[model samples]
Target: MSKFILNKILPLFFLAFILLCFNCDGRDSIKKNHTQVLEENNLIQEFSEQVTYIPETNLETVTDTLLSSGYKIHIKTYFNMDSSVLKTRHQDSLNLKSYYRNGLADVIISTDDNVLFSKTITKTFIRENLSKPIEGLKSFILKSIWIDENTALNGTVIAIQMEYCIPETQDCLTFKLSVKTSGEYQLKQL
Candidate 1:
């Protein structure tokens, strides 16, 4: 009787161990499959579609509404004093040139590497002889008033403020311009 009982218990224990091992393996496989499914579906790509570009016509309406809502659009452009070439450090200043001149800037809108709509703004700029142009200029600064996301179009509407300054003159120019960028802009993500 004792021998027979020992035999039964040993087989039961061995069977239980094998079953647990198989169960754990099955769970791991399920987890892997779930991960693969998620990767295939790619949440980032899905989220990209939800973001839409504001049409050019809509942008005008939006800008008008924003202007009426007491939102002042300020842009500053820093030139090389004489040349339209942008300063390396102040490259962002040129984003609104079209807007300041025509009240709009043409922008390429993309969603997750997908190009949506390309449009321009109506911001315009007029610069006089603010300073003498310099040659072989090294660097400059362009700063503009901050505009929130809602007031501007879906893309980035950068306000250019400063022009590149030469080492000798240390003078720069500012122009008010608006740049319109759409679809997956860094500002939109933030």
Candidate 2:
């Protein structure tokens, strides 16, 4: 009701969520049909954190959240991919390849009716952490987002971690973002 439900602030993760959907061809796939479609469109992948598939739209919402130190942290992600990239089951018949992947991450930090932080971070957020900028128009996956209480070891109010992946070469990088109660945050390449 607060608007963030679908399009408002309540929206965008994985510390980890393995999607296992029917592959139409009788094989099992880690990605749902709708997820594949969104990636192909090179658009924002729509879905909720729910792992269940919606036959009608093949989408749910892809988001993760946690309550910590009086602040609520929500991490939402949208996957992106290049249409040219073709996906095929590996010999294992499970893992995906060429599987171009990219994503948009929305991190929302709030308390009660007041919002302290909201950011839609892209690969750029972890740019400095990458060995080199991936060249050409390719796909990247906002692999995962999670709350890391271990950050308490660092004395921060809250710590969030996100992983960016490039399925083409099976490369992924995890980055950590921490915010103070004041709503300030910085991305650190973990």
Candidate 3:
């Protein structure tokens, strides 16, 4: 009688244990699904699409292509622009406007893979085709209120503040360009 009871009760307990194990929480799958949703929604893109920078030197042994020697200046730009929703009656007008806003700019100067200087500029705006129809809206403009440049001897360091406007019209936007250091190798800036 005892053996019969043991066989029946043991199987019931074993089945309950198996069910519990199968129902246990598995968070790994949940996290993976969340990431997939973000990618599908265009909330996060691959690194190449968002990161841009100038390399110090480019040496292609196979193609024999070479870049000039100098400190490589890397500029990474991030902007929140919803270009998908832009609509205009004129097809050409749609092509002329830039929807760049809330820009974040990162600048890094490096040589031989060693970082020499780094700076970040935020709260910048980029607009294209800001002119009137008569004047022809054919320009790309960057505007930033916070801008300055430092100079060094034997090197040209210039930070220019530019806002080109039609003197007859008040249509204008701000821009900043800097060449912190210019030499045989560090002559390029953006």
- Against the reference, the lDDT scores of all candidates come to 0.35, 0.57, 0.39
Using TM-score as the measure, what is the rank order of every candidate, best first?
2, 3, 1
Give the CA lDDT, 0 to 100, for residue 117 in model 1: 39
Candidate 1 structure lDDT: 0.35
Q: What is the TM-score of each candidate against the true structure?
A: 0.19, 0.49, 0.27
lDDT of 2 at 30: 37
Candidate 3 wrongly placed segments (more than 4 Å): 1-69, 80-100, 124-172, 177-190
Candidate that scores best on TM-score: 2
Cα error of candidate 3 at position 151, Å: 12
TM-score of 2: 0.49
Error of 2 at 189 (Å): 0.8
Clashes of each: 28, 18, 0
Per-residue C-alpha lDDT of model 3 across residues 1-190, encoded as one tens digit per residue: 8897789988898899999888887654566765476676675444113221212122111111111444455555544342111211324212222222333456555556565546554322122212222232233222332223333222344343334332224566555545445311121122
Candidate 1 lDDT tens digits, 1-190: 8898789988898999999887876554565654365566685334322321112132222321133322334332222223233222213212221111112333333334444334332112122222333343234323222344453544344332223333234565444334344322221101
Look at candidate 2 and tell me the lDDT of residue 112.
Answer: 76
Sort order, lDDT high to low? 2, 3, 1
